[model samples]
Target: MTKKNKKDIFSSKNLNKNPSEKNTYNIDHVLDSVFGKEGTKKRELNRKKAMVLFRAEDLINERKESGLTQQEIADKLGKDKTYISKIENGKVTPSVDLFYRYVQAIGKRVEIV
Candidate 1:
């Protein structure tokens, strides 16, 4: 029934750190701690990978909403079910053209904002 400050919500409470210590934790801090600093190679790579995973999840939801199965999408794209599965699982990154094909195959369209 009380509001927690952002630091209190994101601090190292699970790590057994002293609650009295000043906590500067936020999303950026957590990302830097887990994936290295922004602009570093590790962080940059992780950022790209994260984007790919997000897009994959979006495609998955869109396909489900459209009432299409992975095999059906694969049929539309002339690919095997495993290929679509790989993309959804983040084991594959489709090219821009292929990504657009995926969106269209699921009865969706891409719009630039």
Candidate 2:
């Protein structure tokens, strides 16, 4: 058997595209070509993350409004104050159940929209 040439290995035809043009690797272009531009992969991911951040911020504000110290809130949630701080600071993502417990500890109701 003979050794393959470097050019043969690096050629676009050997890979995934046409050798003649530039390919735009933007999320929109990729999704449009693969799944369709109407695909919600990017938007859905961002929206879900934004919602979690919004919920965390709301919980922090509510806790402040209720005049409860972080330690107090932590005690109510059966967690450490550091954990409460992490949630409030957006250092960690809380589960739906934990979010509800946080809101309740802050003397507020968790409303899902």
Candidate 3:
């Protein structure tokens, strides 16, 4: 084949036609391209969202471990159960003080790293 034909055959656009093609579009690569490098402005937003999700997951797990009902935790925190539910669902970011209180209430240690 001519060089131009070889290049076209190896291109990502043509990979779909060849099931055995080794070099194809990578989802991670595409995401990186769209979101920019980590710590960059675009990725910072993604990082914040991920942190909120992690916080929510941690809160739920801790509450379960402490055998606390949602209402109970809410009562201890002097907040509404719906507010706690929203935080656990990652619908909102809890204030630092509130987050610390949550950890304390669950008898868990909060490590800052």
TM-score of each: 0.72, 0.53, 0.64
Q: Please report, as a residue range, the 10-residue window in candidate 1 with the lowest summed lDDT.
A: 1-10
**Candidate 2, residues 1-113: lDDT per residue as tens digits?**
12455455445554555446678223343334334346468556656677878867877788889999999988998999999989987779888899888888777885569
Give model 1's TM-score versus the native structure.
0.72
Give the TM-score comparing model 2 with the true structure, all chains together: 0.53
The 10 consecutive residues of candidate 3 with the worst lDDT sum are 23-32
User: What clash count does candidate 2 reach?
Assistant: 0
lDDT of 3 by residue, 35-67 (tens): 567668888887888888997998898899999
Predicted candidate 1 versus true structure: per-residue lDDT over 6-113, tens digit per residue: 456456662344446665333565566667798899999988889989988988999999999999999999999999999998999888998899999887899999
Cα shift from native, residue 4, model 1 (Å): 26
Q: Which regions of candidate 2 fall more than 4 Å away from where they truly are?
A: 1-38, 111-113
| Per-model RMSD to reference | 7.9, 10.7, 9.4
Error of 3 at 57 (Å): 0.6
Residue pairs with colliding backbones in model 1 are none
